[model samples]
Target: MTDDAGLLEETAEDLFEDAPCGYLTTRLDGTIVRVNRTFETWTGLRRVELLGRRRFQDLLAPGGRIYHETHYAPLLRMQGSVREIALELVRADGSRLAALVNSTLVTDASGRPRVIKTTVFDATDRRGYEQELLRARRREQEIAQHLQRSLLSGDLPATDGLEVAVAYRPAVAGIEVGGDWYDAFWLDDGESVGFVVGDVVGRGLEAAATMGQLRSALRALASTGLQPGPLLDALDGYARRHGVGQMTTLAYAELRLRTRRLRLACAGHPPPVLVAPGARPELLGEGRSLPLDAHAVRSARAEATLTLPAGAGVLLYTDGLIERRGRSLSDGLDRLLAEVASQDDQAPAALAPAVVHALHDPGHADDVCLLAVRIR
Candidate 1:
């Protein structure tokens, strides 16, 4: 060979031995024919121990060996090449290392496969980063769950002449905790019951914090015996003062058991549904009012009064209950009414679960909060 050709071959040999990735050449039957210095160092095996004596498959961990025999080798043989794939390699001392491997068939001048050329890249750092990302996601979910529990009122308050039950179901499992909340507490007189159901516009910790603030402020105001309309007005004022953006929907109601009367007010929220004894369930119609943060914009006030006869129940719910994607609001309302009408005679507690199940379906796409009050 000419001197220049010899120099070129020497340079190529040096580059292959010091390449960043591990390289190996194996006979078609799997005997290792040649290996780069990087491969020998990475496996803690000297060239003498690896060359001609061991096969490429011998370096793989047990599971990787099985996968190679069952899938990788067959696919490579059919396709003539295999791209980057994750696999575990067993080192000389029996330790395992994660790696990405790429392999291709080497053919002779006769167009027949003679050997397999494989490149291995360490993936331990990439795997560590992936594990870190999963841990961060899990931590975020844990914090969200804690915030959701804190946003909830510990227990349903006992009220005179009323049976109240509340249920909250998140849209997704694990990460399902969200900003929907319900509260039932007695006014100062201790004879009147005031309740509110509301939803924050978003999810996660920020929404949960806003929910907590709104629920606390509303409860504090309701304790002073404000009627439904005035109570919501107070809430709107508080929301504006706090600079809470246009991101809230709420329905507030007060039940006067002495007179079997209910006064309700809504702020850009779905109207409450009332089920009377031996009567169909119907939504209480009230005027439309803007949600809390829309205070700057002139909006109409909403109020309605209904007489709750003995054995009737009033339901306050978040939009998640009757709302479904690709369905009109009217259609959702109709479905809710049908479901309520089909229920058997049951108390508010039992009826609450039935209503939730009725709203339950693969089509439901949001979190739900349901609060029911029955006049005994």
Candidate 2:
């Protein structure tokens, strides 16, 4: 060979040996046939012990071995290549190395499968970053939870011959908290009480914060003796001026104990369930309007009124209680009505959780907030 050709050959060999990533050639069945010095250096396993003795899949963690059999091997054969599969390698010391792997199926002259060539990049730094992110997300979720608890902490208005209760549950499947909230407070008139359940749009810390702001605003507005409809109207202006909680939905109601009069208004919220003595549970599907701050031009919101008999009850809740993927809203509503009907005789405290437990789907990715009030 010419001297320059020998120099080029030597350079190529050195490059393969000292490359930044691990390189290996294995038989179609994963028996290691050849490996670079970098692979030996990274795994603390000498080439002599690896070549022809250890299979490539044997070097992986147990879970990765299963993944290799189920996904990696199948895809490599079918597609002739696979890229960026994350896995963990079991090193000689029994420690783990996170790796991003790429592999190609080598074929013979007639396109028959012959061998597999693989490259692995050390993902320790990337793995560490991802772990730190998860930890940070968990910490933020805890903080938002604390904030949510503090914002929701308070007593519902209960007087003689009146009972009030509430239940709140966050989502089960995600790292971020949701924006569902509930409240009940006595109006200026001692005989009347105001209560609400609302869902602010969005998630995480900002959603919780928006829920707090809207909850406080609604309470403040309700204290002015404003009825539910006008109260929501004022709340819409507050949200627009403050640029928060736009498109939020809530059900607000006032119950007068002396007269047993019930008035409710919905701002693009789910209808409240009404339970009266000697009657089947039914939806109060009136007094509905658009969600808060939904339109550029504001109009007067609507309110519905009804006279409740003694021993009647009302349920106000966020949509999370009933909504599920692939399920119609009316179906959810129907299920909720059925659940409420089953708990007809229960008091507000017992009924709140009973209805929630019955309707809350563990796999649903949303927060649920329910408020129940009964007049004795």
Candidate 3:
């Protein structure tokens, strides 16, 4: 060879010997024919121990060896090459190292298989980074749960003649706290009681904060002997006064035990469900009224009526309970009614948890809140 050719060959050999990645050449029968110094160092095996005595599959971890024999080797033989794929290799002391492997089949001049060439990249750093990211995400979810608990305490006030039960579930399992809330309390007159269930428009801290503010305002106003409609008007005024224009849906009701009746109002919210003894669930207070903050000086009114002798339960829920992508609101309500009809007794306290569970889809992308009240 000429001097320049000799120099080029020497440079190539040096590069192959000390390259950052592991490299190997094996005969058709899977015996290692040649291996770079980097491969020898990575596996902690000497060149003599690796070259004719070991096969490439022998360096793989157990699972990797099985995968190579079953899928990778056959694929390489058929396709001539395989690109970067994650795998693990066994070290001399039986420890494993994460790696990305690339392999190709080499053919001789007679068109017969001669050798298999492979390159392996150390992926330990990348794997470590991925694990750290997953840990950080779990920590963030933990913090979010803490914040949710702080925002919405799990305490509901007891009211006379009302058996109230609430169930709140976020669409995401790890995040159960949401902006949906239920409240019940005796009005100042002590002759009447008020209950409200509402949903703030988003999720997380901001939505929960808004929910707390609205709930507090509603309770304060409802306690003043104001009827359901006027109370909601006052709430709308508060929303306007505070420049809180975010959309909210709510159903509020005042019960007069002496009259055996309830005054209900809906503000761009789902109708309250009334389940009577041996009867199908029916939607109450379906009047059209704009949601709070939809317009200044809104003229929303409460629909007042007496409960039937067979009065059993009332259910109020956020859209999450019945809303689904591509499904109409009426259809969702129909599904909820079907579920309610199938149940015996149909008391709010009994059906609330079941409804929440039935509506919760692990793949659902929205939050849900349900409040049920059964009166004897």
Candidate 4:
């Protein structure tokens, strides 16, 4: 034989035996017929131990073996090839190797089934990368949760003749934190209390930060003796000027403890619910306007005023309380009103949580926030 022919044959053998990926040829029944040196080295098995003594699926983990038999084998037979199926292989030392496999069904001259040729690529690094990404996401969620809880913490305004309570629940089905928040405190007058329930525009850390900013800005604006309508207007200005919370929705109210007078305004938020003594619960639909910073040129926001009878109260909430899949806004509003009316005449503290729980939807995917205030 010529030296050139011998060298060509040797190079081909070397390429098959020492390629980066493991290579194997099996019979139609998956009995190993031939395997390259790379496969033997990867599985910690000798050629003699693998040839005719084991099958490709036999080297897989128990779960991988089941998947191979049920999906991989049938698919390869039907389509004549399978590509990039991830699986785990149990090596001779009982260790597992994450691998991606591709297989081709070779046919005879008449196209009858012959042997199966497969290549296996190591996938440990890829698996590690995916796991690290998941861990990072989890860490971000934790930090956001902590920030949200801290920002939402604090005491609500409570006095002998007045009561305030709040309840907040995050989305149950998603990994990202939402931007729902509630706050209640005394205005500078010390006789009237200011309370609000608001929703910022986004999710995660950015949304939580925006919620904090808007809450602080609203409180500062309210303490300056701004009524509900003008308070929201000024807040709109702040949002537009600072570029923080555009299109945010909220219901702001100020209640005088002595006179039992309440003033309220809603900036594209759900209408507040009114619970009056010896009267049916109803939504306060007046004093509504577009969401904060919704328009380039703002219009005058409206405010409503009414006297609350003894034992009367108001409920302010975010959209998550009355928004649901497959339910119209009117239907949700009716349901919330019904739930509120059905609850026994109770203090704001117990009433807030009870009403929230009654309207709770396990499938809801946004934050729910409600604030209840009552006059004795």
Candidate 5:
């Protein structure tokens, strides 16, 4: 052979044998026929012991072996190639090494399958780092869930002739808490009850913290016997001065048991629904203004009042319930009123969940809260 030809052949062989990644050729059934030097080095096994003796899958862990049989082999045969398969390989010392593998099926002259060529990349460091990230993410979600529960934990006010119930659901996206909150508590007079449904502007841990602060603020303000309009005024002032729930939308209502009277105010919030005895259910959209802290100089928020005659109920919910994508607000509102009218005879506790569940869209990623109050 010419000296230049010998040099070129030697260089080609050296490159194949010493490549950083492992390379191997196996029979159609995965029996190893040719393996590069890098493969032997990574497995810590001698070529004499592997050639004609072991199959490629023999070095895989049990789960990876199953994957090879069920997925890898079939995919390669069908697609003629498969890429980036995650698997674990058992080395000579029985320790498992994380690997990413790719394979191509070589065909014979008549296009029949002949052999398989595979390349393996070590992924120990990458797999470990990915696992660590997942663990940290899971830990964060757990902490947020705990915090969300603690902030929302409380019982609704109970009294004679007056019933209140709430249905609170986080966004459908799993493993995370959202900013939607509902609260029902008694004012200082103990004869009047407060109903609130608020949606903060953001989500996650910070949103939970903000929701807690706003909830506490509402409870404290309700203790002072402020009317719904003035109460929202106070809350807007709080949001502006404290910078906590800026642009937060909420509905506030005070229901007096003796008079069966309800006064409600809305700030950039959906109007509350009123279901009257022998009358149709409809939304009270008159009291709404812009959400809190929406302008540099906020204007006075309006409030509406109505006597809750016997068998009348009020329903308040966040926009997540009736503000679906591609659907008009009027349409959603009509749907809500129709559902409530159909089921108005049900008790408040049962009615609240049933109405919200009927309108819930699993594909929507927002919190849903429903507060229903009935005066007997």
Candidate 6:
């Protein structure tokens, strides 16, 4: 042969033997007929052991063998080819290799199946990366859940002539913990109690962290003896200055037990529902304004106040309680009035959960927070 022709033939043989991927051929019944150098090198098995003594399925893990017969074999027979099927193979030393496999069925001149040709590519690194990503997502969810539980854990104010209760449900999507939260705590020793239900603007751990900060700030601002309207104004300032919880929505209320005076304010949030003695439920909408940090500055927040006749009830909640897709806000408010009207006579301790169970839309794509208080 000429030198150039000899060199070209030698390079072709070398490429077939030392290609990056494993290559092999098996008989129609899957008996090993031929294998390249790369296949023997990959599985740590020699040509002598594989030829006529073993089949391709013998190199698969036990579970992979079943998958090969049930899914892979039939698919190749019917379609003449299969691509990117993932499977595990057992090496000669009992270790395993994660691989992506592709195959084609070869036919002879008689138009009958002659052999199956397959290419195998290693996939261990890719599989490891996917597992690590899933683990990271799980860890973030756990941390958010733990932080939320700790922030919400506490006792409600209980005293003579007053009853207080709160109900909360996380978002239905487990993608992340939500930003909704509720608090009912004492402003003074026993005379007044403060109620708060707030929602941060986003989801996941960042939203939970921002919520913790806002909850703490609101509680601190309320302790300064400010009424609901002024307290909300101060909270708006706090949020703007800290550059945290921008556009957060919330409702704040202070109830005086002895006098039955209820003061409430809102920031782009759902209005509080009031059920007076012998009257239909109504929403206190006079005190609402845009959410925190909506603009640089604006008119001071206005608060709504009314005398809560003895045995009257007030229900405060976040948007998830009444809102639904393709429904008007007024419709949600009207529906909420009906739900509260039904439970006007129930004890405060039972009112929150009952209204939540009745009016809360499980289909809403956000968290739910409700606080119910009754004057005794």
**Reference-based lDDT, residue 124, model 2:** 96
Stretch of 10 with least lDDT, candidate 3: 302-311
Residues 235-341 of candidate 6 have per-residue lDDT tens digits of 88888888999999998989988888888888999888887778888888878888998987677998988888788888888889888899998998988888777
Candidate 1 lDDT: 0.83
What's the candidate order when arranged by decreasing TM-score?
5, 2, 4, 6, 1, 3
Candidate 5 residues lying further than 4 Å off, grouped into runs, are 1-10, 45-49, 52-55, 65-83, 104-114
Which digits, one per residue and each the tens of the lDDT, describe model 3 over residues 1-376?
6988977766788999999999989886678989889988887878888878988888888888899899888988999988877788888888888888999998989878778999989999998898899898777666656766665565554555567787877668535346677777778877667888887776655666677788789888887777888888888889888966367879998776666577888888888888787777888855447788886556656555656443577788888888887889899999988887887646566688888887777776677788887766
Better of 1 and 2 by TM-score: 2
Pairs that collide in candidate 4 are none
- TM-score, candidate 2, is 0.84
lDDT of each: 0.83, 0.91, 0.78, 0.91, 0.88, 0.87
lDDT of 1 at 283: 90
Cα-based TM-score, every candidate? 0.80, 0.84, 0.69, 0.83, 0.86, 0.82
Alpha-carbon shift of residue 303 in model 3 (angstroms) = 7.3
Residues 54-105, model 4: lDDT tens digits: 9999999999999999999999999999999999999889999889999999
Pairs clashing in candidate 6? none
Instruction: Write down the TM-score for model 1.
Output: 0.80
Task: Please identify model 1 stretches exceeding 4 Å from their true place.
Answer: 1-10, 24-35, 45-90, 94-119, 123-126, 173-176, 298-300
For candidate 2, write residues 60-136 as lDDT tens digits.
98889999999999999899999999999999999999999999999989999999999999999999999999899
Worst 10 residues of 2 by lDDT: 337-346
Worst 10 residues of 1 by lDDT: 293-302
**TM-score preference between candidates 2 and 6, better one:** 2
